[model samples]
Target: MSSRDPAPTVSADEGVPAAAGEPSSAAPVEPAPVDVPAPPEPHRSRAAARTWALPVGVGVLVAALFTLYSLAQWRAYVVKSWDLGIFTQLAQRYAALEAPVVHIKGPEYNLLGDHFHPLLVLLGPVYAAFPDAFTLLVVQNVLFGVAAAVVTWAAVPLLGRVVGALVGVAFGLSWGLQHAVDAQFHEIAFAVPLLAISLAAALRERWRTAAVAAALLVLVKEDLGLTTAVLGVVLAWRARRPALLWLTAWGVGGFLVATRVVLPLLNPDGEWAYGSRLDLVAALSDPVGLYDPAKGYTLWLLVVVTGAIALRSPFVLVAGPTLAWRFLSEESGYWAPTWHYSAVLLPVAYLAMLDGIDRARRGRVRWLRRYSRYAPVVGLTASLMLLPQLPLWQLTNPGLHFAGLRAQAARDAMAVVPDGAVVETDVGLMSYLVGRTDVYYLGNDNPVPEYLLIDRQGGGVPQEWGDVLQVAQILHPGVPFEVLHARDGYEVARPLED
Candidate 1:
């Protein structure tokens, strides 16, 4: 009786049949199919707009501050005549659509031959419009700021919002980047952003964009080719893409050609003057121990400031060759944080730090996970503490205050020297006279200038009245030249003929 006992019971009002073993009222009802369209794909542009809003805002703020600070430095006449002057001269020639010849380096030294930096050609258009040292400074600051923005954008996905913002801030305010800005113009300014974009693109698995970005770094500086090569290696390893490996060869080959073939061909001496520093063994074996302890301390601080997490990522290897090259150089200048050499390293360091943070968050490393959570705070605090040590601190000091009277005096003296005249002057005055005249450093070789200018009260290479007389007599013997104008410690002397 129990085997055949189950039967469906029908409802009095509804027509739908119930299951064979269930009562009609107790059966489950199927819902009618409703046409619900998938939520319109989140507007990509709007989503991107939200994603980039914070980083762009932060980048603009940093860039504005840096630009104002740099402009102040320019107005105060704090910029030196060496690099700033040399680059200005090159840019001026580029603006005029002429070969980028810099007389400040020599009588007519082609800048491209000296450094193989074709990237500087881009500045020609900017300087063509603005045509001043201040314009160059502004361009550099803006590019660096953009680079920071790119870093922030990259870090956000890996480290979350807060840590990502810290990475951007730390990178923007890094002593190396600030020092490069303070030191005036450098080819590395372009390299910084390009490298940041390349790393970010690689992390996002945008292989073609990454390759393009990495390849362009070669034009920024010859040595940066090595960094690009490392980027290729990292991309190939992570994505298991063989075609991208060609970038590695491109970078290595570009570096060799620039240094060995192109540079020598362009050099007047038939050899790259900077080649002496390439001997790693010699640099490592410094007998005088001139490598300052301060430099070592700076190196340590750079590493520690990254929360020591950068070392965990393979991307950190991108910095290895640069660090090695710089540390191995016999030049003490290369060892210090005072110059722009470390500017390119900042992007690499911060990107690697973000990668490490991502890895820790995904893994079971307790201490790393804990540290990663607070890394932004740690990085920001470190940056603020080190702020005073940067050139930016000079902004608050009175020493950099712009002196209108002194500036006028210098300008007036430069005005007296006719355009196209060959002039020899000290570092402080060289930048002012570059584009208007054929300018040369006071002590470089046997520079016989049609005019001799100097600031008797200027803060540059010490020039006594006797030193000018001595140089004039040695170079232009028996050619009588008289002071055209002398006032406010600024003097211009010209040949009687001119």
Candidate 2:
């Protein structure tokens, strides 16, 4: 049986005692009230965790993939001489605390005087530790990966984690980025992540952060100051802030000073060689010649793949200066997809696309709202379709082996040459020798080299070198030379005794 209920209190006026097991005709005592708060929701915490997990995971995965691929290329010795060699030598000089000069161009051709990129000095310590071209390759890939991560972070708030992850993947695998990675290092590597962070901050209306980030672009390249100026204009117009408009004006002013006054002062040539192509009217007239049709098609594909959403955002304006610079330039290389020229544009395009999608979701237009839901799917599909065309796929082919007997022999041949020797080599071998040897390109108008190195079967050396060796002659036919080593398309010769 249940315990008996407490007996009611009896009134004193009643003056009666209650009988055992019987209730009195008095009121029962009331229990005191106590406050108890509800427990927190587990689902809310789980949802927050899920929100960040996908984009972060995607970012890490893509970065790892690109890094591995680039390292593989480095091991394969597939990287070229013109840029990678130049940068590696400059970095080596910085590491040694010497003036950053390049002998590949000529003895004592100061890199600082060539381009006002003081930002490269920061990599000096890193190069000291690693001391190879591979170090630069890995660093560049990591910088780009950081950019992809930044884009992912920016996208998650607007598009949700899943769609944001897709955006990150698309951006990391984009043609511009892939080409830049395959093409070796450039100053633009620093610009990519900086631009991404600046744009991401701007999108969130973090004005001070955005301004600081944009302003730092001047350190990357003088021309990038113009891009920063355009960003300032975008921010000022969008937020209606007068102070931001002044930022825009200052950006332009800074660009002029950096390009016209400062760079000229530092440059040995007393002028910027890059400024020679500023004829706007001529560039506008023959637009067809400025860009390849295939590249033009890719640009069109990029827009359509995003459902043309990029065009709807003001961020698209950031792409204008870069595009105009490329098209208007007399250099045909700028118009092609072969280099890092277009890499800077990828961040702007994708960020603008994301912004447009966000705007579409909030607008009253019904069709756009529906289309916005499928934006990630469209982006992913387009990225996947273009994957086969990328350099990463070439790794799978057996022809691109990193290690073999012939390669090892060539490497051994390069090693036999002592450090600090004045040598002339083909374009392909110049990079390997740049840091160790006073190497020069084997071409017409070359000074008489003390030693001649060539790849006979590879056909990289000039045809004239073959006749010289056959005739036992040097650049100065009067200077006799002795063959040092000749094997499997690799040949090294030195000046003979008098």
Candidate 3:
């Protein structure tokens, strides 16, 4: 025991103990010193703890790079979509502990109606501290980084630290994740890391860890419940554990509860909004119609990036629900690999590759076992080749370092509008204004804001500063409105007092 720790009043050995005032009967006896051998377990544990430093270090490095890229894009006004603004507004409401009434979607539209993501509320405390759109962006970047780290850590035991680290680099530079970064912040940002942890645990047959992680996906987004069901199938089939069959029930039941019950109740229309959007019957009837070149390309890319070796593992089955819903959806964005749609697929692909390789190494097939050793090299090569065409390539360009005229114009327009003022806006300045001002999308259903903020280049309402007056006239005809700041397609206007 350390000197600071209190000593036991009595000796551990009964014979060695005696009252302080009362003398021991057998002469003066000295307590024998015990030589406790230092357990090798603790030393091994410390060494094992030291072993994980590589994965943690690698994840931090990759996350830092991603965070830098995301922040740079924000600084340069690289508005991919209005998603960043929408998520920011959701965070704002959650921070205030208010109902998620996002005006940017429509007048007091509870975003839960559009999509079920109570998990986004976790960002409430974060937004409470920073209260900016970039806060969400940063959180997403960090999650992606964490996913990469988990992937690396998983590979470490099977592939060793160096190859595992390489796998992480490939994951960081993968198309799905890079595209997610390009698409801006999304609710699925939470899913990427969770799935990574789940898939990694599945690789080692940690059923409890895998199922628990998959269970959480339903909260991140409603449809992930089906994804959880698929995970249960994988676990049941691979582990041969009948008890795990309950996950399928949990998943399907949760999806039903979230969609039919929770979503409709929270919805502004008192109905499930996206229930009818899936056209699976039409897709199945005319199989030719389901043949989207983009969809085909995304599917091919999923396996090819893993050297097509990931197909050997059943863990890839976890991705079936996500791909099924995407291809089956009527939304064109869902069919494409771009945007934030495919980020969930990347981790699955990499994990499948590792699982496939690890399993192959032990199999009877000689050629396959020999080939598995070189698979990581192939995956790394593919990722590097594709890096030039993806978003991370922006890091190599010296031109991306500085903010351009459009960014300056956005700042100028926002500066003219005072903080806390209600402003109706387009996607261009929506993210910029949502943090400090009340922002509503330019739509007839939403209430008229005190200030009209539009970008002639922003689309929907206006694309340039010069177009603000026309939008004001269209919305409020015969009501004189003063153009407050109109420059470089970013404009702000307020209705004149009578």
User: In the order shown, what is each candidate's alpha-carbon RMSD?
Assistant: 7.4, 7.9, 6.0
The superposed Cα distance between candidate 1 and the true structure at residue 362, in angstroms, equals: 1.5
Where in model 2 is the C-alpha error above 4 Å?
1-56, 266-268, 285-295, 398-405, 443-450, 456-460, 464-478
Candidate 3 ranges beyond 4 A from true positions: 1-40, 43-45, 398-403, 459-466
- Tens-place lDDT digits, model 1, residues 1-498: 577897865434356666698775674665556566897788999999999997897688778878978877766666544888888888999898999888778766888788989988999999999977778888888899898999899988876787778778778888888889878888788998898898888778888988999999888888988888998899899789988899999999989999999889888788776888778666557746645686687677667777777777899999877887777776777877778888988888888877877777777889888888776666667778888888888778745464445777777888898988889887767877776778887666645678988776763645543544554665578866787777777777766774
Tell me the TM-score of each prediction against the true structure: 0.86, 0.83, 0.90
- At residue 95, candidate 3 shows an lDDT of 98
Q: Go through the candidates in order and give the clash count of each.
A: 0, 1, 8
Q: Taking the tens digit of each residue's C-alpha lDDT, what string does model 2 give over 1-498?
A: 346977675444354566677677545434345455878767977886666576667667766877778777655556544778788888898999998777665556777666667788878999999887778888888888788888888888887776777788788778888889878889899988888888888888888887888888877887887888898898887777868876667668877887788767766678875787677888779877666764586477558556588887899898888877776777766777657887888888888888888888898999988988887687778878878888777767736554533677578668768888888776656667776787766653456677777766543655555643753354456777778887777778888766
Question: What is the C-alpha local distance difference test score of candidate 1?
Answer: 0.80
RMSD of model 2 against the true structure: 7.9
| Candidate 2: worst-modelled 10 consecutive residues by lDDT | 26-35
Residue-level error in angstroms, candidate 2, position 81: 4.0
lDDT score of residue 356 within candidate 3: 95
Stretch of 10 with least lDDT, candidate 1: 459-468
Best by TM-score: 3
Candidate closest to the true structure, highest lDDT: 3
lDDT of 3 by residue, 19-125 (tens): 68876675555546767798666577788778778887878887898888887787887787778888999999999999988888888788888888888999999
